[model samples]
Target: SSPLDPRYTFENFVEGASNRLALAAARQVADGSASGVKFNPLYIHSSVGQGKTHLLQALTHRLKAEHPEMRVLYLTAEHFMYRFVQSLQTQSALAFKEALRTIDLLVIDDMQFLHGKQIQQEFCHTVNTLIDGARQVIVAADRPPVELETMDERVRSRLSGGLLIEIGAPDAATRRSIIERRIALTAQHMPGFSVPDDVIDFIVRNVTTSGRDLEGAVTRLAGHNQLTGLTLSLTMAETTLKDLIRVTDTRRVKIEDIQRVVSKHYNVSKQDLLSSRRTRSIVWPRQIAMYLAKSLTLRSLPEIGRRFGGRDHTTVLHAVRKVEEMIGSDEALTQEIEVLKRMLEA
Candidate 1:
């Protein structure tokens, strides 16, 4: 009956540089003992399923783990509004407000859902009560304070007044790690289940958008295995995950998105990128685009070659190799590609 998932504890939360700041801030909020305003309202902002909810739940879990009797509450913004509305209609608003004030740590998720003047008013009042009482409050939203223009100014200010932590888009390495972690979690349920590293790398290279997508891939693979009782292999991964391959935002990553992002990053025109020009400028960007297509999609070398203005498989192979070599030694190029990959995935 708890709002927090029992499994979302600090031990399971995988951290990388992108999310390190947010994780540290959440831990601080959870450990601070002052009854007065110490990181009064910890604001966490991240795109969907980037571990903001996980971090919030982890904070709650740690608090309760450390202090069994501590008063705590965790609810989505929708649930908070629902309770507030129900209490008003039932003439028990006083009880609702009193109960909220008693919680030592109040965690709210999906704060972007808080809208409407009445709901905003109630949320603001509740936040004010918590902050004024020096009780810790945490909120998660898809956007930061300035972008959430619909929210009350006072509430927005209060949220921004304290610490603002952002759970950024996870990089390729981090995404791969997350996929491995999810696979390990799956193994806990199915004793002998296992997935190969290359298969996991395939999923990582393709499902670049969010942690949820990685989890979904793991779930699908597990479900398929459970039904057929077949061990997982690259061939199985290729066939079974045909739909999940190269998808971001619950849909397939179009060749156009990758081309557009790469072209923009390298300052080349899309037409020139796909054209026959072998200029050093056009060559490398074009190669990168091809490399991304190969790694992120199921497109065959010939298909990819055909897409790049009748270029041969040999040319595409050369480009892919050059980029891979550069990625291995060229730190600047690697960073550039990482940014582009993140954009395409986003």
Candidate 2:
């Protein structure tokens, strides 16, 4: 049986600006437009804990519901390799290929796992066969196809050949909606349980990482609400989610630590950040590290710049001020930087 999670259906999915476009495209594919298999291999990319798995599983469930007669295969890249290897061990390699090729719809989650030479060839063959047969295919990964460094050019090109969609980090309003939906879902099992609007807003403002963190926040709040035998309030939320919300939870962050964290979170090389790669990718994360280095450390702008590629004090000061100004006005940027800060502190 397919490992599709029923809880991840479209009904339970809370649509927001961040995921609206991806959700719509997934819907169009799920409904099977007569215009033909237009968006073959719908590649959805996003950061970890963001709803890639949810959307992939939701599409599988919808396809199974709409067309029961269609043969649908939903599995991760690891599981696919497992099955393929099993078929070889069991002397059913040909049968395995036949089964994979004949499916009406094929969906693979975490496509980044299809990186090795042999595995990429096998998976690429399967995808090519399916696409040639007019069968719909969908894949999800943490980065875009072009950014998949481990994958070969042939497979990477094929993955990018399809419509690529990137799901951005959820904004504050989206986080609030997610919390509300999570609360409603929890109420189904824990009747008479609820979180106050203020608490939800507090969580929405504070827990700005991912949907998974939002789920954790609600779970903790509900548990606390039950223990206290009263509504969850702002005060309780502040105390209960203390570690989650507090950016200063850890000791003073070192300049080295800030650079490593910012580089990793932004998926850029640490040396690139220290180097003079003024490209948007390198510059943004460098500025973020500069900002964090200033805010979280007692070091001055000149000191921070000295640590970061021996840049001028004015550069570090500008970076700090820029991040501060963006955090105030840019809701999405604020959420992203907040998540990075929280991850670093934790």
Candidate 3:
């Protein structure tokens, strides 16, 4: 199977002030004609769901189609680490390095999750080798190189040497276009699926977080319409997406904010929450913070785990489920989490 998602091609990407420059740069890289040395290791950063992965894969797809002979490899930072670890276990680290170094184009996603000393050193060496050979490299992350505190400075410096672009949050017009595109795509599959302009405008105004959320809102409406045999209406949109609408007006919540608020509420230090204490005091607060981060932010489980002291993504999932179970059975805990949520959102 192809590593890239077919749906995330450049044709489907919505352009706006937020991501226009990033899109143009990505197209240039795909065409193998970007200005000399500037965009070789094109570094793209953004918060969650801001089309970094889409543009990366779109570039990969175009490169594969237009220059089929070029050796292109696209994988997330997690997968790269996994493969390196596997190579070490199998005693084929040399072969792995050789293969990676020889690729014509390299695309790494979620660079924030890349940790550990030896792996990062190897990554830096590979990037240097590829760039020195005039190969193209692209990387995406949740934040810019300077902000990746866990990553090695050498890796950050190498990435910083190239073009760094950020995809900002979509404005109102981009949000509308995204909603329209999603509705159009859905209509292709379900011919009766359509969102009225008023409903569309309602979604644009209220689902103001990211393109993914807007797509999700439209999906929910389409599901309801298909199941209940009712035409889309502003009332139905409001009713179906009440939760999203409620949070849209609030400031965007970050994982750091969740950790800080949860720590303060539980009377524990933020460091304690990120520590491996395993005591009830630290564990509960830690779990609560993870749950809040999962619920209030768009971070993936692994990304949340990385934020919370490099715990495994399954650990974050377990914490979330534990907090959820307690909230159902423990009123005080439920009230406490509610208070924490309000504080974070506030």
Q: Highest TM-score: which candidate? A: 3
lDDT of 1 by residue, 1-346 (tens): 1367888888888888779988888877677653355576888887777888888899888887888788889889988988989899999999998998888788899998887788888788888988887788888998777656467888888788887888776788888788888889999999878887888888877776677777888999999899999888888888877776645552234567788888988899999998988799988889999998887655667767887887898888888898999999999999988887788766
Q: Evaluate all candidate structures by whole-model CA lDDT and list the values in order.
A: 0.81, 0.82, 0.88
Query: Which pairs of residues collide in candidate 2?
Result: none
lDDT of 2 by residue, 75-150 (tens): 8988888888889899998898899899888888988776468777888899899998888888998778875656
Which segments of model 2 are wrong by more than 4 Å? 34-37, 246-346
Cα lDDT tens digits, model 3, 76-170, are 99999999999999999999999999999899999998889999999999999999998888999988787676789999999999999988789
Question: Between which residue pairs do clashes occur in model 3?
Answer: none
Q: For model 2, what is the C-alpha lDDT against the true structure?
A: 0.82
Deviation from native of the Cα of residue 15 in model 3, angstroms: 0.8
Question: How many angstroms is residue 157 displaced in model 1 relative to the true structure, after the best TM-score fit?
Answer: 2.4
- The alpha-carbon lDDT assigned to residue 182 of candidate 3 equals 93
Clashes of 1: 0
User: lDDT, candidate 1, residue 99?
Assistant: 92
For all predicted structures, in order, the TM-scores are 0.69, 0.72, 0.74
